[model samples]
Target: MIILQANQLSKAYGAETILSSIKMEIKHRDRVAVVGRNGAGKSTLLKMIAGELPHDGGELIIPNAVSVGYLPQQAVLSSDKSIWDEMLDEFSDLLAIEQRIRLLETKMGSEETLSNEASYNKIMKEYDTLRADFEARNGYQLEADIRGILSGLQFNGFDYYHTTVSSLSGGQKTRLALGKLLLTKPDLLILDEPTNHLDIDTLTWLEGYLQGYPGALLLVSHDRYFLDKIVNQVYEISRTHSQRFSGNYSYYQEQKALQYERDLKEFEKQQSEKHKLEDFVQRNIARASTTKRAQSRQKQLERRDWMDRPDGLEKSVAFTFPTDQVSGHDVLRVRDVTLQYDDQKEPLFPSSSFHIDRGERTALVGPNGVGKTTLLHMLRGQMPPSTGSFQLGSNITLGFYDQEQAQLRSTKTVLQELWDRYPSFDEKDIRTVLGNFLFSGDDCLKIVNTLSGGEKARLALAILMLKKANVLLLDEPTNHLDIDAKEVLEAALSHFSGTILFVSHDRYFMNQIATKVLELLPSGLTTYLGDYDYYLRKKEEEKERLALDALEQPKTDQEDGAQNESKESFEQQKDAKRKKRQQERRMAEIEELMQQTENEINALETALLQPETYEDHEKAHDVQLALQQANQTLEDLLVEWDECSTDNA
Candidate 1:
């Protein structure tokens, strides 16, 4: 069924029209991803469909009795209610039905001449129907279902009973709202950037849940991976128009390119034909004998359906920064670092040691709250380490770009902002830089407050370019950028010879730009000489080994009892002279081994990057073999250490 349909939909804010002549049909069971760059009317479309906003010029037809649930980009929940009560409210309809059924059951059991046969029969019939409906909808297991959904979304072991909505963090509130929407089981689900704050595990669960959802889904998200995993179709709002793609995001990209090529070819053919017809008509129009032919040609020209030329990324700014002076050999150095926020109880990364060589592109990776941003702040000199010290080499200036660009002035226009930041830059230079970043003539007049997330990111990046710093520290630099803008940034980073230390969750972006990956774990920070994908594979191997060892550990009563005694003894003698000597020797050997492997891996990477070596089959094969061995050895060592620790425990 056509669950939702829009015709001639147009929305305007003041004189600026965000959407014009938007038409779309949302069918039942269709999973559509509404995609566009930031500030591309995606949220506005959802609001219109949800009846939260009126369309200025459009006809909207929604089927009667069809329910629609909308989860906006930002959602607020009632503060007085606990998480448990918030979810329970989704089933208000079911609760009402249950009340009626209960009342009927009570009457059926009463006296009044054995309940009058006909009335009793009617009551029983209604009860049976309601019961079946309830069962079909999984009503009886509503609490369990709600609990499962919440748990899957990483609310496991949480005290939802006491945790009120207002007490929950922003991410928690969003999850709570998501749980409610799932329980409501509406005919249409509209979600905006639902995966913005979700962790990998939670996102995976959401993908599975949405896959089995029986209703239509309209989701707007910048998470390409999530959209590709969940959505079957893509609705792209572009350049004052909306285009539909018949397949997943990856397929849409492929098809879009193919369609563009086909259109260009067709247009070329039509233009060629038109030119020939025009030539024939112009030459024969004055000849009496050929007047009929000229008239026929003119008619053909008037009747022809000329093809419109394909336009590419509309008004996309082309930006590139001038290179800066070379930095010292040692760009940044940290020794035995230990950082702790005043408000945080735990240290971010203690006993951490790292060195950033000039022109090395590194990606800092970890789960949320694992100190990715904290580490960046420490590097930028905005925050000091609790213990130890860090140094920036002489002549190595830093360009720091926080997710929330702190330097932006809300009251300043784009030009004024640029000028204020870089007084040395002439107007021509400023315009050129802005143009490269996609900010054009009148766009330069836009106030900071009016700019979208992508625009802000772009503007911040432009400012970074003007600084001409030899070292750049970025935290979630791609957080607010669309795919196109991300591509632009990636291109800039790829060409940039300066040292870069970035924290980003975008795996694709990391793969393209990261020359090395640093993983921050509870134990310490470990640097791997490769991109994010390489690190992921090694991490997975280590995880699987740990899981396998955990499964195979001795758990019998006799084994447990023996281990308990041994553990006690071991702890008691942990500080003894002999034990301390043994521990130090083993630790020294492990450290030495890690360093040796790192050296070997670095050599192999250097060779792999060489054009001549990569082209040679034998040399490339050798490099690959050496890299695999080094990575495998590192993973094996980690697993072995984990296993020994578990056994000792």
Candidate 2:
């Protein structure tokens, strides 16, 4: 069914037109992506479609029962509630049903209810209906569902559930907000730049989740790889007009290129014919015999309709990394380098070792908080590693591109920003570089503080290019760049002769520029001598091998020990076996106890909610005490179980 359809949808801000005429349709479970440049009105169109921003003209149709969930660029969630509680709010109706069922259970068990057939029947009927509704909605797995979403959003630790929304960072809050929205399961999910803060791992996870989602998805994101994986249809908003493409990002690019080429050729052909006609008219108009023919040609030329030139690709940033000097063959080397945080029980990086050769574009990748950027910082001499050492080879000059563009002087103008980097250069030369980076004319006078993220990124690139450093360390270099700018940057980096040790979650960039992949893990660094796709394939193969190896493990009993050995050795082995067996037994015991404790806590909670228990202080207190003890016991069991499992591993 068509959940939404827009015909000639128009939106504007006073005299300025944003979306003049937009047309698109979203059917059941349609994966649609809205793509455009930074200021191309993509967001405005989405806002209009979502009804967050009013439309000035045209029609948008949404079915009465079709629910929509919109996530703006910044998911602003203001709440004092804990993360888990805030998520629980999404299922308030199901929770209400649960409460009603509990009340019915309490009433049905009463002597008065048992003595009255009509009252008992009515309560039982209500309870049956509520229970069926709850079951239909998967109410029995409420906690499990919530846990799955939280973990997928990287809120895995037990304590994260209790962390209030106000305490979370903006990015973390955005993640939490996304998780809460998933729980709501709206019919249509519209997201703006949903992949902004997601790392490669989280991006893949979300991609998988959305692929399996039953609802339609309409999202705007500059992440091309993300768009390629999730979207089947693309709506492009350009020059205040909308065009729909019936394919993913890659397919759209191909079609757009082909169409442009066709239009260009047609225009050139017509111009050639017109030029021939003009030349003939000029040559023959003076001759007496050919005067009629020349006049006829001139009249034909005047009557013919002319086609305007088709627009080409947008002007993108164009600059290359010019190395000042040659570097040694070994650009950088590290041995046993890692960091151990005081708060973390395990070191974030465990004796990780890797090296980058001269001219190698090494792409460093890992999950969030796995210290990819921190490792780059250590290499840049911003800080020392917790242990081990890393060294740069002979005559290596490093240039760093921070994702935040923190190195740029916000007080300076865009023109001054580049000029300040190279004092001896001619002013024209500096301006030329800035102009190549899309800071032409009056744009160069804009203050850095007022520049957008993409503008700041361009300014930073201009400086990095002028620095002429032989080795570059980039952290999320594509952070604020749109798809076009990212492609330009990727091409520039690909052509650079110097070694590149950069961290990026842009999988498309990784695949485009990476000659090698360094996967930073808790255990150590794993090197894949290929692009992102090769790394993924190898990872899957490794996973399958590990699964098979796990199943092939040999099992032995206490009787399988060596029959004859030195007493010391025999006794030590026997004691170790006995301890292992005891730990295993304790694990089984804890599992049983945890289940019992959960049942006890539920029963106690139900009793505490009853009228008889709450009306009497002594009974209420006793039940509450029992519930507390049960909860504490469950917590203890979980900790012990985790330890025993770790020991076994």
Candidate 3:
């Protein structure tokens, strides 16, 4: 069932239209994502759907029974109540229902009501109905639900429950708001930039939780990895229009590229045909013998339908990191490094040791408040470690991209910020570089303080590019960058010859550019040889191993000795031989099945390539479906074959 629908929806501020005639729909249990570049009216459209903002034009149809809970980008919770009580407020209605049930129980137990059959029966019926409703709402497990959500959101600090709502930090308050929203259990849950302050662990937990969520989900987030894992449908708002894709973010990207190519080809074909018609009309109109034919052609041309060109392409900032010099093979070395804010508190990392080789892109990652930024600062010499030391390689020049962009002077204009630092560069050269970062014309005159977070980030990157340092230290470099900018930066960094040590929460970015991952922990730094995905897989394998080990009982010395002595027994040897023969037979069977499935898949693929199959949509679809099923069967057989071969070995 369609819970919400928008028909020609539009929103405007004065004369500037943010969303123009946008149409979209959200069905029951739909995991929909509205994605766009910064300031592309994604949030505005969400607000319109949530009824927080009024639409300038068009109709928004929402079923009256569907309750929507909207958590804006910056949700503020101001209350004198403690965090626990604030969360309890979400269940006020259920609490009231419970109160009525209690009152009914009291009246039902009274002598007057007991003597009255009508009153007692009515009270019993009311109690039964109320009890069922309460159970359906999970009223009895409210505290358990709240606790689970809070733990999943990583609210385990000392002040998690004790702190008052008004006393919490902005990020803490946002988290609390999210917890409350989840507890409310609305039919439709809408979250804007919900992953803004989430760490990797918390993000993983939230992804699992939302995957099992009972209601429809609509979220706007710049976290591509999060979107790919959560959202099944993508509605991209670009160039004042909306386009829908029937798959996850990664699939959407593939389909979008294919659609663009197809549209471009169609456009070129139409243009070629129109030009030929025009040329024929022009040549024949002047000849008296072909005047009637020319006139007919002119009429046809006037009545011809023209296609509108696809216009979603907008200019994006270009980024490149070029080094002026090369550093030694040993880019960085750390030995027994320990970091702590104060002596009274525990150290963030104790006896951490790591090294960054030349041209190695290392990503520092951990849970929030695990001192990723502190470690980066220590490496930059801005903070001194409590113990041990780190040394930079010979002739290593450093360029840093601060997450807060504090290196930028707020008083200076965009043009002056770059030109003032590099006095040797001419004004035109500086402006040209700024323009490359998307600061052109009058935009160069805007003060740094007034610029948006994205603008400040671009300006910082521009300076970093000009620095041409051999060692780049980036702190949350992908923060505040739109998806497009992040992609561009990823490309630039992937091509850079310099060594890099950066801290980021962007798993997708890390997967693209990171050569190694250094996970900072309270215990110490753990290094992974591969990217973020590899790190996660390794961690999961380690977890599984630990869990399996936990399940096994410890053997006594006598039992161990007896088992060791019985290892070469005749019965054991005979059983092992039989098991090995069985494993070998199973492996052979799996291989045979895999080969057969592969052959079937190949046949179907070949049939799909034939003209008769290709021309008929239904036939082609059937062939493709059969090929997919065959491929899946082959994959299963391969897995089984591997397991059997391992057992035999």
- How high is the CA lDDT of each candidate model? 0.81, 0.86, 0.87
lDDT of 1 by residue, 223-339 (tens): 777776677678889875688776667778887889899999998999999999999999999999998999999999999789888866555545554556888999888998887
- lDDT score at residue 225, model 2, on the 0-100 scale: 91
> Where does model 1 exceed 4 Å of error?
13-16, 93-133, 156-158, 554-649
Pairs of colliding residues, candidate 2: none
Quick one: ranking by lDDT, best first? 3, 2, 1
Q: Where is model 2 poorest over a 10-residue stretch in terms of lDDT?
A: 558-567
lDDT of 3 at 279: 88
- Per-model TM against the reference: 0.77, 0.81, 0.84
CA deviation > 4 Å runs, candidate 3: 100-123, 159-161, 556-649
* Of candidates 3 and 1, the better by lDDT: 3
Q: Clash number for model 3? A: 0
Report the Cα lDDT for residue 561, model 1.
Answer: 78
Ten-residue stretch with the least lDDT total in model 3 = 562-571
Model 2 vs truth, CA RMSD: 19.8
Give lDDT: candidate 3, residue 154: 81
lDDT of 3 by residue, 224-331 (tens): 999988877789999888998766788788989899888888888888888888888999999999988988988888898877676646788897999998999998
